[model samples]
Target: MALRIVSADERLSAAGAKTTMAIFGPSGVGKTSLLKSLPPAETLCIDLEAGMKSVQDWPGDSIPVRTFADALDIGCLVGGVNPSADPSGFFSEAHYQHLRESYPDLVQMIAGKRIIFVDSITDLTRQAMAWAKTRPEAFSDKTGKPDTRGAYGLLAREVIGLLKHLQHAQAKTVIFVGILERVTDEFNRTTWQPQMEGGKAGRELPGIVDQVITMSLFARDGDGWRHEPERGEDRRLVCRAGNPWGLPAKDRSGRLDVTEPPDLGALLSKINATRKG
Candidate 1:
């Protein structure tokens, strides 16, 4: 063991912050629909679970990452996949091993990209459960309780691995989308919850992303419904992140904020427009 040291302080760019976004909300909410309008050429969608083809109406080429390793292949980084009836996009274990073995190469490829999109990180949590099912010893330890060892461990590894990839990306921007599911709570009759709210892996995702958004479709109020100012709205959707929607909303110019349930498209358009001005 001779003397060898590596410098910790490394700065190679004059660019700004890295964008890692998470869109969270209940089912039937317009997470994917909103993001569909985004420039697919710049944003790469890694879809593990989907009902979005018809819903989002994405128009481009698709390269499937059935297993984790498949993601490591730069070829799978294909940009345009015209929407069809086929669903071959997802993450799997076989792909995971391939990714692990070819990690360095994938990291390099991701570094060169702008927006890296994970359709839903929720599938990875399920994948973690599947991964845990393989470990006999860990399974035996928590025989009755929730099995959180194997799959959860692997999920953590995968997420951390991707975050590590983002560090090398100069103009990096990442968006992770997960469906919103309702969970019954002691206080409310049935409250909305991010599908990833439970489990070991669920807890880790929010911290990694820059902002988390929750979108929902609400019933009309007044004669037919309760807990609202008025009624007759087609589908009442509120976008809440830091606080309650709290009145309609104000535009940047001190005007009216038009969109109801905010999605990637609205946000991106605003951001892009602001830059142009």
Candidate 2:
């Protein structure tokens, strides 16, 4: 086969580029409500946590993901198969083709949708771990007993594969929302991390997406801890790397400000406005 070269102009086309983002925030900070900021016609939410009450009035479509199987199916269906992966493995071309035959209606359900929204990764990780526990890898071969290490290892692979599958969708933006947890070390240093069952998925997630955002409530008093708006705090998204606070955030686009208003639609617009005409 001849060496097929794709020109830089073709590769950097604005229409061909899309954003993959991971937004983390503390619970009850209205993370799910960010969906409302996006165009209803272009957005599809994968409600993993069953926490759609926050955006009950948002007139957009959502698919309820109740199990790990549902997550894999939806991800493969929406994102398409990774041909480079093992053909026999899950989320591969074979698995995706089988899902297409099983779920014929999913195509029309997601028609014209450009943004794939996952409500929360925390619940998704839990579901993945629960399913992992049932697999043979989660049991010791000799003792036939439960193996936490094996289960977590499998869980990490499943979650990362699913996320990367979604991120591969062409000309479509994939946004994963996750719960952020505050941690205090022995040295009295406070740090934040994504709230997932296994540490691997959260730790590796930043490398999988173009952006890592931390959504939080900021007050005039310089404390971002209060969850109550009545207490004079407003929601903000930390979009830049190396913020003064120990928040996990990065912007690969090199366009966003240190803090942005909590709006998914606007955030995406800025990220995608890089290519020339």
RMSD of each: 9.7, 2.8
Instruction: Tell me the TM-score of each prediction against the true structure.
Output: 0.59, 0.92
Runs of candidate 1 with Cα error greater than 4 angstroms are: 1-17, 50-52, 55-57, 68-113, 135-154, 160-168, 186-190, 218-242, 245-263, 269-277
The whole-model lDDT of each prediction reads: 0.48, 0.86
Model 2, residue 32: distance off in Å is 0.3
Give the alpha carbon lDDT tens digit for every residue of 1-277 in model 1: 3576544322212122345566665555456565565666666666666545754457633334454444324322222221221244323334434554666565455444566667666664565445445655335453554555554565666555554344334465566667666566788766555675235445655565545555444454444422222222343333333334332112222211332434455564443342322
How many clashing pairs per prediction, in order? 16, 0
**Ten consecutive residues with minimal summed lDDT in candidate 1?**
247-256
Q: Top lDDT: which candidate number?
A: 2
Candidate that scores best on TM-score: 2
**Sliding window of 10 residues with minimal summed lDDT for model 2:** 223-232
| Cα shift from native, residue 53, model 2 (Å) | 0.4
Please give, for residues 1-277, the per-residue lDDT of candidate 2 as tens digits.
Answer: 2579878777777343578999999878889999999999889999999999988999999999899988988888888878777989877879888987888888767657888899888999999999999999999999999999999999999999888888888778889999988889999987888999988998889999999999987765454333333353688898989886668899998889888899888888888775556
